[model samples]
Target: MPSFWSQKSKCLYFYFSGMMTKHKKCFIVGAALIIITNIFTVCVVKLTQDSQSFCPYGWIGFQNKCYYFSKEEGDWNSSKYNCSTQHADLTIIDNTEEMNFLRRYKCSSDHWIGLKMAKNRTGQWVDGAIFTKSFGMRGSEGCAYLSDDGAATARCYTERKWICRKKIH
Candidate 1:
């Protein structure tokens, strides 16, 4: 009877030990996976912060975009051509923030934007987007420029300081 009890105790001990070993292995694997996931997440965040939104020299950085306020004035077509040479285009105000920013920063001088008169006499952006007419325009000409109060139109041959924009990414 004593031997039988001893054998039964040994059997129970072995069973518990095996269960503990399996649990330990599972815990180790889970920990390893968590560490790996954390490392990968950190790497992705660092890359995003360091590499995703770089701007060129002399361009002002703004929320995933870069804007260049030209020092020299040019006609609408010539200004567009100048921006293309710099691998950018005349600024396209896609939102109120951009519009307000340009309005505030232009500083007492009219700046030519991408807007121009289309064949149908509607204001169109250089990328072919129809102007939403978010604000009133004041000119009676073919090319539009951003002015102190809002946008105004002038002849395409009229020279004005301009804004250029390019995506950061």
Candidate 2:
């Protein structure tokens, strides 16, 4: 009877040991899968971040914005129309670099920018932006200020070369 009990004990021990070995294998596999999945997720995130691209031809890239300079001379309304035709809007002056660039090639005259009179308020800029920087008024110059009004309003019908800016993938 004692011998029989010892034999049973050995069998139980062997069974338990086998079960533990299988569990260990399963745990190792699960841990490896978790590690692999984490690495894959990180790679995907980096790839997405690296996929950004600049705008196409005729669009100038500046400070995360693309600008298009129109060689054609037209009124503020027509200039905006032309820009819209090209899937862009009239250039909205936002900073000194943009202002200098525009002034540098000012089409021999003051061209109309995208700035416009606000429909809701007098002298309010309607371009859905607020100008926090001070680009003092080029008085009576009709141009729509991009991001908001720092540039003053001028006559709408004045013909001058213009710029257009757009955002695209």
The top-ranked prediction according to TM-score is 1
Residues 1-169 of candidate 2: C-alpha lDDT, one tens digit per residue = 1121124232222234234222224455568889999999999988776555566675667767677766667877888789888878777776798777666644444455666654433343336666443476545443543213335565687676777777656
How many clashes show up in model 2? 10
TM-score of each: 0.68, 0.53
In angstroms, give how far residue 8 of model 1 lies from its true place: 58
How many angstroms is residue 137 displaced in model 1 relative to the true structure, after the best TM-score fit? 1.0
Poorest 10 consecutive residues by lDDT, candidate 2: 1-10
The regions of model 2 sitting more than 4 angstroms off are 1-52, 104-109, 117-126, 130-133, 141-153
Candidate 1 colliding pairs:
none
Could you tell me the TM-score of candidate 1? 0.68
